[model samples]
Target chain A: MHAIQQQYWAVRDYLSPVLKESKFKEHGRITPEEFVAAGDFLTYKFPVWTWEKGDPSKARDYLPADKQYLVTRGVPCLRRATSLAYTDADEDAERLLSFGDGSAAGGEAEDWVETHAGRQSNADSAANPGSIDDIPDLDGDGAHEDEGLSSAVGNLSLSGAKVPDTPHLDDIPDMEEDLEDDDDAAAAPSKAAPSSNTVIDGSEIEVANGNLLQVRTYDVMITYDKYYQTPRTWLLGYDENRTPLIPAQIFQDVSADHAFKTVTIETFPHSGTLQAASVHPCKHASVMKKLIERMNAGVVEEQKAQRKSGSKDAKKKWMFRRASGNGKDDKPLPDDEDVEGMRVDFYLVVFLKFIASIVPTIEVDSTTAF
Target chain B: MPVVQFTQFSSLVQPTFWHELTRLKLEVLKLSDASVPLTAHYSAGRTIKDRNTGQEVALGCNFTVGSESFDEKHSLPPFAVVAKGIVKNYNTIDEFKNADKRALFSQAADEIWDSIEKDHDASALNRFLLITFADLKKYKYYYWFAFPALVAHPLWDIEDDWKEAKEQFTDKQLLSLHGHLEASTTPYFLVRPAVAGDGVDIAPVEDYTSFFANVPTDSQTIGFFDPSPHPSSPGWPLRNLLAYLRAVHPTTTSTLRVLCWRDTEPAHESGQWKSRFGVLTGGPAEGKPSAVGWEKNPQGKLGARAADLAPMMDPTRLADQAV
Candidate 1:
């Protein structure tokens, strides 16, 4: 049964249309060339990350020898996952995610993305507790409203027709309120997340009491997945003493929601014998597509707002704080009118934002101000 | 006074190190079992006290090496000591096991002794050797680590109880010392309070004779980047340094203050460094000293540790099991 499914997946993946355009709005997955382009863009924006060469024996023929993978080393992780109180609500959202293998039977990519959107709302609510009542009800079959676009083969642009149906995507007022709350939360780190458990091992306390000055640091590397056809991120963690953390210990650094399910210990393709905790790339495309759609919806909302307010300069603030690549200036982009979607180069920056949600404590993503 | 016995170093060979070694084997070495130069690191691990004895337990120091060890330009952490080591990769397990273990160990020890005695390279005091056989086909690796220390005829005796670093120097002085030591490249060095005032002055171990020329013999302090967490005894790297010291200053019988410099966190000015100070009195014989050092397996027996990385390394098995 598994072999048959594997054969089917292989066949479908083989037949999946190669993305010719740079934008990955339709499917999160990108061609190898697109992955290289995105990597170059990420490296250009964040000098901390650089393209590194892999072992010659394991080098893929398709990728350049010097640019086989992207690496950012010694990214500090202040605390453990246990330190972050896990709310039952977060677990419910985690269960809603479809992070299974990339089999065609795992349902439509749009449906998977819709569920992901629902989970992100829950995550958003978890971050901003005051907006609990304002969250639009996502119960029943009304959740997967847009069903026509789901497919493994095609480049049907997500923003071609109407805006995505996610309520929070269009709700500018609530998003602004959430941003205000986020800035407040950033100022006062105590009330940052709506955590339930009283097990708060603050970084200062850990350093003061336990003499744990050397916080665990991780090396984050992104490699292109051949089968999943999306970029897969791998983490290699070092403990306070700088000893490599085993897979089990590495899981402690990951958010409880995606610990063992979404993350797996596997041999790094570039470095043959080395194994690391990799964020599974199965649902990457779906998640990326949903994020891109939400980004477009955000722009459309801004465009509407700009039209209503009659502001001379358009503010293209990237939806996310960390993923605000080249959007930090808050200036109107030259291609603001083209608002077709985020350029494909921003795929990795957005992907990193998604990863930051999973590993909230890792500081690598913040190296680039954008 | 009790005889001070140093704790041996435990090897923490990271998987990335093995992966890099495998890469070098396949791409660079290619069936040629040659010695590869490697620089490892060791720091003072956490100090744990025995609940029953109420005494600080001597934990084996850890000497670690990883992917960065292959990068010659990689800068080490401030608290870490550059432990010079060599990797002898064997093509097969039989060759690794059946090889003359004693001969290889003695040869490594002899080279270190020559560096210490003839070349007078103080940095050679932190020499170690590793032998590995990476069975790439099976995704298994058999390895052993050795940290050679020349045996002292009369093992040094601790003349006094260990005192915290804060006991001897103020926080300001320690901060200055920490700052100075952060830039030190060699593991063994001489540290003393500045002649004029507030901070401390540090000089390489090779400048020992000149460093102590003006200072009172009673106040001279010798320090090394100690890797052990033992509250009473220093780590293994100190033994060779002590041996070299005694050989150089044979006629002088004045007590030498030894600093087990264990900076738990050198990056932060927590002033919570776990360093200790104790005085030692004794020395080894003048002639060529015999060396002994071979790390035991986890079970406390002399054997190589084997790691089966197939579950994590095999791509086919991983893919088949993934869905």
Candidate 2:
């Protein structure tokens, strides 16, 4: 049913006249020029991300020289997504899942978040359960109310269990053992195997407390996807020992909801023969549009509340003035508030927020405020 | 006192390196198996722990090379030791497997030794050889990297427990030494306290004879751009430098103070000092030191590593796999 609606939307979008004014507002899509502009804004504001020249042979003319794509290296992935699911931080999980349904804009989103964190992992909402919540967004709230996603959350855990059944993780135990043997064999090429490294490797990783201190790092790259007209994110993960992670090991770090479905191994467009797991951008624009709409709705609500209370705080007034400011020469600030303010420069920032939901374990968004 | 064991250098070949190798093979190196000079760099290491035993594991230090390595005049980042490398690309996988790896390693080792003995080029100590078989049709590359370091006869023993370099020098002095080391193009250098007594005077390794001429035997200090982050051990490059030192200072029986210069940022502000000072005693064999340095594969075997880039390189496979 959701697939049919997706098809319908795709057809409707194709049949409709192309939007001339800020296509990102109507649809999540942007031009390659906007991609470069957004990339510049991202790098300028955050500084964690830098534009890379990449391979000169693969450089696209639309993007500026030395700005073919954006990259932020050595972003720490402290733990795996599986360990994050049944974890502690409730508020962070709530905020992370607020946009889980992709189109949960306005008042309905609040209810979704209130019950979202405790009951389900990201895989639950990211899977078919999203269709249930999405139904209300499309066919109005009251037509077939059905308890409004509280029941959907209960049913999702069963689907969420299916996440562990991915073929990539099935042989993880044996694979890990093989790697352990490799370490031993590599250090002592003889029968004695009495190298100090053997002793060092054994003690520092797992102590009595059982807290694994292996620090897995990732290099995240964002490239403009011309086909999807959205920024595509690629993750190249490293093991605690700084070896490049195989595809199966990399899958363990990605969110189960999108692991094999939305993310796949593809050669980095800007690089030669270097393949990484990249999140598919086909659905990115649609999800981004909803997130923007949600932000605009929240802004409109806050403005209504402020006007009702008649609170003329100077800071609040400054924000209001900027929101509606029609100055002839006043260009919007680089790190200003997002979306409805029509700050298209904040596109990648919002896109990163979307990516954070996918790879929550990787701290790539730490450099950006929001 | 303990026998010193130098940390070996593991090869970290980037996919772009293979891609560049393929391009070089098709365009430039066709029908010729002549060795080509390439560049690799030694960066810092991360200590990985054993999952089952929970003990600390010391991984071999990595020597990373990439597409830019092929550029004749490529410059590495600060504090990274320039790992001079030679690539020997064979035409077939059978030839790669059947080739005499020991003889090949010795050939490279001999050139490095000649540079040390004849030319007194201090940088020759940090050399690596890469043998590869690029199966272009299948997009699979089979390669092995060996960083040859000559083994001293009666192996050098640590004369004392390792101490942080900061303990031996003031912040101002360390900063001055760091400035000198960063400015020097050669990876190896000589250092001693200034005669007038403000800071240390650092000289390139070529001036080792004159630089240590006036200095007393006990105070003679030599430093190298250390790549390994191992608490107790220095990197593989230091092995050859010691061999060179043994040859040059043949008659001396005095203890030598070795400095593992591992600071990338300046010593004053960064606050993260990885440099170490160790006292060593012993020398290489009389005429030539025996050498042994071949990197082990990921599976703990002395074999070439393989990377299949079909999913990345093949257009049809990539399209099929694309979401």
| TM-score (0 to 1) of chain B for each candidate | 0.90, 0.90
lDDT of 2 by residue, A223-272 (tens): 87665668899988666444555554565566767764687776677775
Against the true structure, what is model 1's DockQ? Answer: 0.06
Candidate 2 local lDDT, B1-323, one digit each (tens): 68776766767666678888998999999979989999888755444332223444544366878788898676454456677779999997667766777688888889889998898877678888998888899777777778887777777878766778887776777787877766754578888887776678988777878888888876778888776657677777888888887786676534678988877556435544668889988853488866777766555555566665554566665444443
Docking class of 2: incorrect
After TM-score superposition, the amount by which residue B151's alpha carbon in candidate 1 deviates from its true location, in angstroms, is 1.8
Candidate 2, B201: how far from true, in Å?
4.1
Quote the lDDT for B265 in model 1.
40
Give residue B288's lDDT in candidate 1 (0 to 100): 86
Top TM-score hit: 2
Cα lDDT of all candidates, in order?
A: 0.64, 0.65
| Candidate 2 residue A247 C-alpha distance from true site, Å | 3.4
